[model samples]
Target chain A: MNIPPAYVLTLSGILFALGVIGVLIRRNAIVIFMSIELMLNSANLALIAFARTFAPAQEALRGHVFVFFVIAVAASEVAVGLALIVAIFRSKESIDVDEVSSLRG
Target chain B: MDWQDFLSVLPFIIVAGWATILLLVDLWIPANRKGITAGLAVLGLIAAIAAVISRFGIEREAFDGMIIVDGFSSFLQLLFLGVGLIAIAQAYDYLRRRDIERGEYYILLLYSLSGMLLMASAGDLIVVFLAVELLSIPLYVLAAFAIPQADSEESALKYFLLGAFASGFLVYGIALVYGSTGTTALSGMVAAIASAETTPVLLFIGSGMILVGLGFKVAAVPFHMWTPDVYQGAPTSVTSFMSVGAKAGGFAALLRIFISALPGAAVMWMPLTMWIAALTMAWGNIAAISQTNIKRMLAYSSIAHAGYIFMALPAAATPEVAPEAVRAALFYLVTYAITNLGAWGVVLAMEKAEGSGLTIEDYSGLGKKRPALALAMALFMLSLTGVPPTVGFMGKFYLFRAVIDANLIWLALVGVVTSLISAYYYLRVIVVMYMRDGEPEVRSEALLNSTIILTAFGTFFFGILPGLLIKMINQVGLLDLLR
Candidate 1:
């Protein structure tokens, strides 16, 4: 009951807001990608903090396990994402998302 | 830890294993022989399906409640494998014709299929996130598979950026829910919510954020800006696979998470989903009528269909109507899969080697030149429009029935009217094919694949015998799961 849920939640909110802002304002694809990672890492922090505060030890382990999975997935996403950026660079000569609107009507 | 539990997930393991094996084989095999890799991937999927059926009705859980093997998961797993099979087969001709055939594409697809299967069985929020990432990461690559095409590469980058952002929302929601309820296991979360001393505002926040994330994946309106661009830019085969398979997987995961885990707070989530459903239907239908590009039209139509599926979510949240609503949703999913895939198959067939022929004008006079393709396309369009004597009609019927039974008369009526509006655009394709005139040219001999033809035939046949499919769906014990 004494755990600082407010602090953890506030951190998550800050991270999420940063991600949204990055998505909205950034024209570079890689910067936007990094912002997303920042958001996910913040969420992981909150999840682990909450698990430690309220859940019993055995059950709390699930949150850590989930973190591991998230990391694995993040790695996979980076691999695919970097490859795509390389592909885009080869074609468009730039990684600016705004300029990549060639498919738009 | 029993073998039975492992067996329940054997199909997933097979696909994952095959993907690794193919990666290694790609190093040895000559580039021109990459078609054999696609063939091997298809065999792996077929064997996986066979394994799933061989263990049908044998319920089990694996890894200490991390995964559940039941009728619902099994049915969806089979659906995922079936989609994978058809997609790989379609890609063989699609990639080869374009001279971009690569073993990595098939391997990535197989890996994605494995992820979807895992998603279908995920019993915990942690597992759900893992499964979702597994399913999404490969699709990010597949969306931009044609690196030579600037549009394809652009689509991939855009999808990845947005997809990663959505995942952030999802994980943030999971964190809040865990904070509020003190558990990540879905069933455990439910119990925690039911027993909590006070209503958890954080839980509601978590649920809302998660809904936004999943909504993006399913291409529900407002969050659907990515759909048309990504679909139009990705290779046709990948778009087809994504439009049907990825949406189905996303819906399954959403249902499991929201309906099962967050039932205690239905009032919080149901209304938000209702508005999303209504807006998606209206926006998708309205926009689609104006689209001249076949890929973009299908993309908008896909959004509208997502709206129809979303309509079932509110009803499923109602204690009195939850079971029937879930069933209707699941049934509608299956029917949508058939029709959507069929529609894409026509698009794939018409596309020239360089992936041209996507405009609505390109389909002009198609009926006169390619009678069989034309007929199949007409049936698919009818099915999509929810016309009578087609699976789409029955799907709409069952979904609306459950909606009305829940006393959501207005929503059901809105749904009906939207279906009518949607019919116009769906039928427009039929009109073009039959009523217009041009010298349509059919390209690949592989277009006459027996499997594609059979798939189309089954779509029509199932429309007539919807009862059989419904019965099979009901046998999946979704009602028990709801309870």
Candidate 2:
């Protein structure tokens, strides 16, 4: 229980802020994707850190296992997401998120 | 380790296996025989349905609590497979007509259906996330399947971007909930939440965020901005799939998560959902009346129906009424899927060979020229309007009864009033079909005719003998699974 809870929470907070900023300011769908990854990673960091700090030793590994799954799923998401972006770019000739507004009324 | 466990997930495995086989076949088969691809997809869907029926009522957990193949999930899986079959059938001709008849369309749809089945059966948070992405990724591709249309590409991009953001929020919520409860199993979380132990405030925050994320997926009013645009921009067949199939999957996941995982915290979230239900119903119905575009109107109408479904959630949270409310919700879902798919099938049939027949004006005089199509559309509209003798009416009756049973008479009253208002817009389509005078050009296209006629028959058949459908739905023991 000697681990610092404050530091873990602060990291999560910072990562979340970065994700929000990335979503709001970035035009590239790829960067927006990376920001989401950052957010999920921060969440994983907090989950694992808390598990280590508070849970029994026997259960500490569960947090890391969950995190691994999260990472695996994130990788799958990236593969599919980027492929979709590439398909869109090939069809529309651009990747600027702002320019893709054919759905607007 | 149990063979029964594998049997529990057999339908999903069958679909995934079919998708892989289709992918391999696409490599060898000539591109001209795209109809064969459609036939294969339909066959796969039928096999999945049969698997679900054979395994129905066998409540069991598989993959170490990651997937639950219980009655609830089986019911939803059957619904998703039914929607997939209809969509694939419709797409055979629709894709060919638009000259986008690649074998990949059916393959992607099968893969997406597999994802939806996974979502329906997911028992843990991690499983939920995986199933959601599996369901969504293929849809992104399908949305923009029309490679030449700028609007199709835009729809795909918008859906993907927003869908990704929602996933981020959902995962963050899952992480926080896991951190607070020390478990990812939904039943475990429910036990923790219901106990008198000092629940962490973080759990509440995480659950709230998850609700927001899921609300976006179901397209409740405040989070519904993307629905109309995405629906209108995507190809009609894809739109039909999304409106019926994707929405059903989203609701299935939402019900599983919220009703099972967060039932103890109903007081905190039920009010928010109630308002969302009210607003979505009013907004969708009112806006639909003003819409000249049939696609846009259906988009609004679909949003409105989402609101009605949301009404069941708050009631399902109540301990005294949870079981009946869940059954009512499931019944409503089945009825809604049939009626909406039928309605969209008519619209798809009406779309001109080259141009999209989306405007309400395009439907004028349809009653006279194509009496069968118009009558089918009328049946669907009447059902949506919640008139008696239709499954839609029975669904509303059951749902509102549950709401009132939970002592939320005010919410039920609001729902009834909204259904009354909804009748105006629903009947408007019928009025235009019969009252307006114009030359209705009947397109005797085979695919359109088959899909429309089949859906029309289903609408009336289910509308009259709703008891049979409800009995089938009730046979699925969702309450035991929830426990």
Each prediction's TM-score versus the true structure: 0.97, 0.95
TM-score for model 2?
0.95
Over 4 Å off in model 1, which ranges? A1-5, B197-199
Tens-digit lDDT track of model 2 for A1-105? 565876887788689779878977999888888887887787788777767755675446656777887788788778867877888788668889888875543
Please write out the lDDT profile of model 2 over residues B1-483, one tens digit for every residue. Answer: 788788878999999899999999888778888888888888888999999999877888887888888888988998899889888877877777778899999999998999899988999888887787788878888987885678787788778777777777887787777767777788777777767342567777788778777777878888788888889888888999988887888888888888877787777778877888888888888888777788888898899989889988888778788888888888888888888888888877787766567677778899999898898899899889888777788888889999999888988988888888888878888998999998765556677677777776766777788778777767774666567
- Top-DockQ structure, candidate number: 1
Error of 2 at B24 (Å): 0.9
lDDT of 1 at A97: 87
Per-model DockQ against the true two-chain complex? 0.77, 0.55
TM-score, structure 1 vs. true: 0.97
The DockQ of predicted model 1 stands at: 0.77
**Which CAPRI category fits model 2?**
medium
Give the per-residue lDDT digits (tens) of candidate 1, residues A1-105.
575766776776787788789878988988888888888888878777776775576767767777777777788778878888877887788989888888865
Compute the interface RMSD for each candidate structure: 1.2, 2.0
